[model samples]
Target: MTKDSVAAVLERLSRLYPKNIDLSLDRMFELLKKLGNPQDDLPPVIHIAGTNGKGSTLAFIRAFLEKSGKSAHVYTSPHLVKFNERIVIGGKQISDKQLLDCLLQVEDANDGAPLTFFEATTAAAFLAFSAYPADFVLLETGMGGRLDATNVVKKTVLTLIASLSMDHEDFLGHTLAQIAAEKAAIFKKGAVALSQKQLPEAQKVLETYANDRGVTLKSEGKDWKIFISKEGFYFNDTLFPHPALKGVHQYANAALAIAAVKELNSKWLANVTDSQIAAGLIDVVWPGRMQPLKDFPLPEGWELWADGGHNPGAAKALADFLPEWNDKPLHIVCGMLTTKDSENFLKQLAPFADSIHTVPVLNALHPGRSPADLAKIAESSGFRNIKIEDNISHALADLTAGRYAPGRILICGSLYLLGDFFSSNKGVKNDRQ
Candidate 1:
């Protein structure tokens, strides 16, 4: 099958279910059973769950394994540009023909039962992974971990919980502790559990859960720490050059990846030389997470960065990175779905941004807050310079033409918005392309 054909099949599958995300394991387990229980046949799996940083952590692990000459399968969510980006088999994206064939097989097995798009896609990914051979499989949970479709796997070599925060209030929970407990449900007995630094309440909840399950908890600042310097990050007393990915948060994610590698302690991984680890750390790449668009169709001397940070915790991280820009008069273009905490997100970002441009997300699963509504939220959050735009291009144009000096523009908020930008600017080439 061609790429277009594969996309068509995926679109059909997406329409089969009315809801985009229905976090439950029963339907997924039944579907997997009908598909011949492929999830049980995967390689040593490393499951990652968190409000943010999961995808970047997965990228780091994949790069590390690949640099060591080992094969890995990776599954991530909310593709930036292509649907196929969600599944990586043996260090390469599953080919269009392979994805289409696997989707058809899954559909045949489901017998037309109602299943969310994420559930069906996850089932298809497991089917493809089971068919292929690899040393490790890195899986990122779609939402909260416990009932997430990806949580059905009975056993995993390593499970990582990245920096947890308050997100997905309606589906997961309203408070940090509640949400942390939902994510902590992925901790299987005897699995090596690694966690990033969390809020006090979240940390306590996760610690209690890990203790009860007898999972070895290798935590940041306790079992391992990362020191950032002018040269790069120092992980476990080993210095590495600046990661290939940008942003300070990346150092934390890299540290978590290194911790996971150490916990695996496999002979194949033990054979990895320091040079391999350094090279992999410097080579990792994950899109729409602090991704810079320096070479896009934008004007010269103007910098554009994109991130899919929709929650307050992510907003705080983005704010922390803003000071590094050094009074460049930052312009923020944001679009968010209605389910997100728009007021809190804007409150966290208001102090650092010179101006805010609110736009609507394209093909958003839930009702998208209009640009005007979002601008109002920003204004209520103490931002004076807020404007509503019809779309990202208009927002970019206004930001570039406005009084702000030749500073940087940050396009952020929802991953769905990033996908829309990618679709509209398909012909605009970038260095990564």
Candidate 2:
């Protein structure tokens, strides 16, 4: 957890670019070119972009492919614990030695010029991925898709866009169409593009983008689908267990992973049987989303959970799923970045909580929204019994000290907050269904 070579490099890169995001591919392209364009040398890639569910979708895809006896290299952003968490080689995270070498190479390649942390590290991931031998690679965009660091891959075998919603509005345009268009730009003309059922506004833009390129996107409820039945999860008519990840919202994401696997027809996955697909849905491991916190110190008889749901779309998903908790009194300890639409996000989660405590994300470079500021928004959003706490420990202490009754605790709002939480709590990984 301490600052290692990889962390040191990341720390320097943070100073090179503003802590705030500057979304574009220009810096990424330049850095990758200096690094010999390792992106092109990577194995057949399945690139994914979206406002939410990008990580979970990748997890399901990785599980399905691995279950089918395939090895894949995965690249995703905002690592919860370590920088090594971002790059996986043949199912294992890159070793510290390899990660440090990659970072050194990427840093030297930049030649002291400015580059954002994500862009520079993306180059390092591609470099490591290209050097490693693997059957496939799963690449997830860091932010918006079009100019994102991962979008440098011109012709992926499959491109996926998961749930889209209003997020990073300052960088991506404010409207849904604008965000959808940015995500659509990652689509390769010859690739089989698939998406979860999008809202009308977002779907229109996606369909228009597909039509303009003459590519028929296989969409949920149109080309393929999945649902939970009495038997279990059903894709078309096949009965499979529920997705390894929790929450009803994951059914669509699992289906999206299945759809992406379908495009693997040109590769080893083409011959994969339905049974393997069913097993994959039952054996995926995604650490942060709805992850139960155990083996950590907590109040007596109180269960804890953590989610990295930062935007309105993610907030709505948590809101929808909480009602099914079978009457557990939900107490949320929340923190969010300053850039997020706190008012809107709070509006969605406020209705589901019994008591809400606002806490500052102490370690974030961009800093969390002030607890007082967040409290005002929560109060206005009709959140019951709001209080401001200095940090997660303080919030938990308040609950433990009889400020609130024992209940189910949810630590949410930002991935950065969860990153800090996991460093100390180090919760057990979720069990595969």
What residue runs in model 2 are displaced by over 4 Å at the alpha carbon? Answer: 1-4, 18-23, 266-269, 402-404, 426-433
Please provide, for model 1 over 1-433, each residue's C-alpha lDDT reduced to its tens digit, 9 standing for 90 to 100.
3345776777778778845555667788888888889999999889999998999898888888788888888899878777888998998888888888999888788777777889889999999999999998999999999899899886588889998998888888888999999999999886889999888899999999999988878789888888898988798788988988777888888889888877766523445666877899877888788888765676657888898889988888887777888757788899999999998888988888888999998787678888989998999998898888999998888877745678788899898898888878876432221
For each candidate, what TM-score against the reference? 0.94, 0.94
lDDT by residue for model 2 (280-327), tens:
887788877998787667778788889999889998899889888756
**Which pairs in model 2 have colliding backbones?**
none
- Quote the positional error of residue 133 for candidate 1 in Å: 0.6
- How high is the CA lDDT of each candidate model? 0.85, 0.84
Model 2 RMSD to the real structure?
2.7
